[model samples]
Target: MHRLFKNALGLRKCRAFAHDESGALIIFTLYILMAMIMIGGLAVDIMMAEERRARIQFTIDGATLSAADLQQTLEACDIMEGQFRSAGFANVHVNHTRNGAQYESCGVAEPDADIAVDVASVEGIGYRRVEAEASIRVPTLFMHWVGIDYMDLPVSGAAEERITDIEISLVVDVSGSMGNPSTSGETKIFELRKAAKEFFTAVVKNDPDDDSAITSVSIVPYYHTVHVGEDLLDQLNANGGTVSVQNPITNPPGLTSVQSEQQFSSCIEFTPNDFKSTAITPSQKLTRKAHFAYGSSSTRFPNYLQFECQEDRFDTRYAANSRPHIMVHRTEKSQLDAHIDTLTASGNTAIDVGMKWGVALLDPAIQPAVKTLADDTTIPVPSRVNDRPANYWVPSVSANPQDETLKVIVLMTDGVNTTQYGQTTENQYPYINFKNSPAPVWRFKNWSTHEGKRHDRWSVNRNMEWYDQYLIYVPGNSWSNRWYRPGDPNTSWDDQWYSTSEIPWDGIAQMDWVDLLDDFHVDYMAEFFWDEAERYYHSYYGWSTREDPMEDKLKASMITQTNWWQANTNLSEICAAARAKGILIYAIGFEVNTGEGPMRDCATEGDAYYFDVSGREISTAFAAIANHINQLRLVQ
Candidate 1:
């Protein structure tokens, strides 16, 4: 019985061992499954965190870009908040300071709320690099079931805002080609106008203070020629009539109506006092051959000339308040509006002409007179008066001369220089002719003929004695048997000949020869008459008589006729000339190949002065320039 009990105990122990082994196997399987679940959950939470971080980062990046482009603080904040909301951020807040620091806040669980946007500047470098960082809490998906509630996510982004003083010239191509339909189905001119207006608004926003600190954009509208507004044209009378008047006169020769029925129908009434006269002979009877009629003439007259003598008439007929010159140089909102309204886009693109006019307008030498306001004693003033006194503020001119003001010219051209016309002061000499003879002249000593020559045939040696003989020839003598004399030629003399070949020809070729003379003749009398007529015409009308250098020469030498050229040259020279002057030149060449020779010369070395941009990237270019100007620290 003891042996059987021991065996039973052993069997029981064996059963127990088997049960323990099976339980161990089950525990191992459960542990393995649990580990797998944990790992899979963690992975899902990581992915969610990554996606949230990516979304936040993208939003921040876009916000930064938008802020960099913002000219106003409110706009920057609005854009940043809008971008955050669009990116699915739960709650977004943005606060930015103009020309200062910016702070951003968002309700991100994992990210730290104390995120800072740090801006760093490198001395001598124009741009400031901005970096932002934030930590946000990302809600877990499956991991939340396993005691894990959220994931901590870190995100960061960087951007650069460059500050540069920009000197830009908006050179628009107002050529005939601009009138063609653009890719947008609108005329290029219309598109340009729209784009320009947008650009102008942007510029105004950037430099809103009117302190002239940020930028000054000079709009240069060029077609075949540049149109200098009538106001600017009035100041450049330096060369007299060398520069043709912008517009010219037009009038019919005869009166359209007669009051008296008794007046002879065939005879036109002559009223000297009532009639206007040309500078030439007054009231000359019009010959049938003379192209004169009473009706409107077809000859296109220049705009300047058209109203030259009619200014008084226009003033009388049109109310002075409604006239174009009512607000000549005032900064009142309506001034520019009225001026722009009067601008009619007609005529060819004269870029050079327009540029010249632009230069003249900006010339310090020709700056408009600044009004001196009488000081107000009633109001208290600051003890330490600012350099820019309130009374010294002018409507058209800048107040502070020391501020880093921007001067820009926008030059656009659809084609190259085709036709160039200008009034020059240089004189061109006319051609003259002269003739010469090959034979030499001689003179003889005085001697009287031997009294009718009765028998005085003393032929002593025909050759040797002839040298000793004394004979004189009269002025009208023929050279049959005449001797050579000292003063008067004993030999026959022919009339001195003058030819056209001897004359020197200089000056511009006339556009129409018929306008100067009817028929070409070598006749001296006709030539003399034409010369007098030309002199008189120039003296009265102010036409150019100088020869222009070849276009190639002008291009090669960089002697540009454009306002930018003159301004650049003036700036360079002025900088070199004055020790106190700190002149900055910024050049931006749009859509042009960077490797072009002209483009390369347009910019200076180092950071702020040079930028080459694609044609479409004007906004970025302007931003860079604005940032540069804002960063300038006034040196003591």
Candidate 2:
């Protein structure tokens, strides 16, 4: 009975203890402690992994950029490996889409795998794209506790950029004013030479083996005229057309007349409005003949001359293979540099014509003509983009953002607008063009004494003999007696110096003169009658402005001022159009008296595209342009 009672008591005590829950807190605390330790360990591992991934990403990013150079070779891979090793990474897998070793430069030839350079030609421009990928297996420390012995840290990077391949037309003003000395004691032309050479070096580096690199340039040096070498005109299909200038058959207005076909200054006359854009259609080619003025204006209508142009020298130059050949484009940088050596400063400024020609070469509508020329000649025209029309240009802006190509023009000038000259058949009487010695074309010195009075007696020489003698003196002895008639065809070569009765102009005379009265090629010549009336008015009256020249003789479209402001404004519009077409226009107004005008407006304002420089500043201007263009090119 006692044992049974004790057992029942023990059971009751056990039940009480179970119901009490006294040790429950301590047991739960111990279990919680164990759980906390496991959670803490996982958190520590995650933190360590994150920090390691961050470090790997930084290393990979640096590696990618370093290895992305198109100029680098396959040895860049070894460099990358070294970098990885230095960064505490081993057995790193470095891979690329092209091999830099095969091509000294990305475009030295075509690209190969193991190289990072490859940017598809956007529109017609070449670009460089690089992609670098790197991966490393990192041995895990803390995470390995969870059955994870290793971790993959992969990082990749890429760079895309627009790089080089430019077709530039450097339209420089080889105008007479460029020969003037600057404050720095250097001639504008001399400064330009130094600047231009540096500019060439800056923009087009020494990359001889890059066949795929299509960077090219056209040196369009202009004065009162741009001799569109017949090769160029013919190639560009600017030939085969006829311009009817004043008939050379007669000078001044003739009561009885004839209209004959004669080519004008290869500088076809285009209205100021014509230059609003670069889309010059086929119909707008050079087809008008340019006319020059007679010093004096008689109610009977003064005689005029055809502006001397390049048509006559076309056949000769093509055969001689001489330099300063009409270069509409040149593929190699060396070719451009060589051509630049042939520049000479002479004649008046013709920015309108120069800029127009520059724009024409970039026009897509003219591509067909260019292709025709290329096919016929040895020129390797840029025809990769458009095989038929030969599209090598890209629009400035379009619905498609990919349309991109660098078409540039660097136009430099040292003077403001001035009158252009032309020549006339004759005076019905002979007139002195100018002295053979170097002097202004508009040089019409009114000597104090015309009639010697045989001296003191102011008398006019009635002898028409001098006029007769002047007409007879041709440049070459071969063409001495054989003189060309103004409006008459080759059949009309006049050999009539013996008949001096027709000789007329009273009072003045010039000594060494090769009367280009009816000729176009100016290998040899005298002063011209261009802007004669304006100059006469200036000398007779006083210096004048474009606003209102004395009596409004109409030197150029009747708008006589120092500059052709209207034309210049038109040029501005053309520049804006070029810019809109994705063509970069850089302008240097070297020693411009007006301090502003067409050249200033031709380039973007305040963007280093327009430089109104002086003396040596020209070099800085050109270098800046080169650098700007270089920066604009495709690259990573």
Candidate 3:
């Protein structure tokens, strides 16, 4: 009976153990711990995969960027594979697509399709874009339990390096105000030189890599006008022919000297029609800027030697130096920097003329002239720029679109447009007829030798020392009453008073209008004749009744060629035309005192292109522009 009771208690204990809820909690906890371990393993696997992907993405980004640079000498696939190997992915293989064409390789001689890479190109307005894409597989460490053995990591990169050829025109202002001090206490031109040199180096320098594309720059420095240079002048249709004029006080009496319109100047006169378009037609006749000084200080009596054009001058007091001429299609950094260093400031501001020349240089119309310049042995244009001043880009019509070029103009100024004086193309002046020949007026060699009395009176007396006197002849009238010495010393001076038709005028010498103006003041020339008329015809009573009409005629010949309003309008039009032709324009108003409207409108519409800077800020502006331009030549 005791053994049977022990067996029943054991059975009861087993049943109680099977139905116990307290132990069930411990079992559930065990299962939860197992799940947590498996989850943690999966998380570790995912983290490892992500790290690999991040590394791969970085490698691809760097690889593609280096490959896409136009300066890179290696093939895109080769560059990418080398980068991958450097990143410790030696066994990886890639299927490469270059500009929509595909090739498979493992960075080895054999083809392997495990990984993928692509490089493509897209055309931009003024640049060509290169895109690179790549993808790699990262082997999984723990997620393989879920039937996933690897995770795919895809990476992409794009770069553009001004693949198309580029041409830049740097238009700079050298106005008198630029000589004044800037906010930085230095002259505007001084600051400009520093900024411009830095900019030139930034654009022309190729750091650690060489580019396949061509990039050329032109420097157009202007004040009242532009000096297109002697070589380029030969290509243009400038009407600067030589004219023969008699020299004053020549012993031979009528000795003629050849006078060239370009003797003192080398500038062209642009008509309103020329400004209507950006085209510089070689066949069209361009008038030469007159070689005369109309400025108040220069027009002072006995000081007409100061010509309006500063081309022939070699003085630094006038400009930085005498080298104020355009330099076109150059690629050498040192050459451009040296050119920028020579810039000086003088003359009035003619922003319109500067802009016109700046745009013209970029236009294809100037290509013919550029070619001639390139062929020249002295100061030859760079061979790299042989095909430049290239045709205006018409993307649709381009035979090989990759051959397109970008045109750019950088216009900088310190002042607003001022009055630009020019000689009129009118024939209203009577002096025009005598410009190439001797006038009908003869001057005494020693008129001032006698006291003021003999100078005012006209007498012919051998006994009274008849020697230096002036004689005048009206077209329909006879010679004026004046004393003249015989050609022979033995002959009497009184014998010449015989008749008006038989006057002995060989003893005196006369000069052409051009020579006369160069030798004496216009007022003096006009007054001498008037005083002679009073002495010869006794017309002093009515002389005051008539004003000095000759002076009015002389002054009227020089009119305001380009006024403020016309200049502004022309500037706007050319800027618009340049934009329409797909040329990029950048304008900077450096310490501008007057309105900035013209300059602002001349630049490209975006704020990135136009800068209104003062003093040392000009350097910042130039740097910004250089960065903005050079930025396009790098990966996007």
Instruction: Give the alpha-carbon lDDT of every model.
Output: 0.34, 0.51, 0.66
Provide C-alpha RMSD values for all models, in order.
22.4, 13.3, 10.1
TM-score winner between 2 and 3, please give it. 3
* Candidate 3 per-residue lDDT over residues 1-636, each given as its tens digit: 899999999999999988877868788999898788779978897788778777777777777667656556666678777887798877665555554665544254434655566656543334445676666676776677668888777777776655457788999998888889999998889999999988887777532234356678899998888877766777777645666553443422453653444334567778766676777867767666765555434323332344456554544333433446788888888888888887877778788888888888888887877887777677568655656688887878886434577688899998898878776654444344322445555655555565345321244422233323445443333443232222222343333322343444554566444445443344444443443243332232122323445444445644446888888887888888888888889999897767988888888985668898998999998888777766643344
* TM-score for each of the candidates: 0.35, 0.54, 0.68
What TM-score would candidate 1 get against the native? 0.35
User: Worst ten-residue run, lDDT, model 3?
Assistant: 537-546
lDDT of 1: 0.34
Full-model lDDT, candidate 3: 0.66
TM-score leader: 3
Best-matching candidate per lDDT: 3
* Error of model 3, residue 139, in angstroms: 15
Q: Rank the candidates by lDDT, best first.
A: 3, 2, 1
Q: Rank by TM-score, descending?
A: 3, 2, 1
Better of 1 and 2 by lDDT: 2
Please give, for residues 178-218, the per-residue lDDT of candidate 1 as tens digits: 56655556654555555454455444333234332233344
Model 2 scores a TM of 0.54
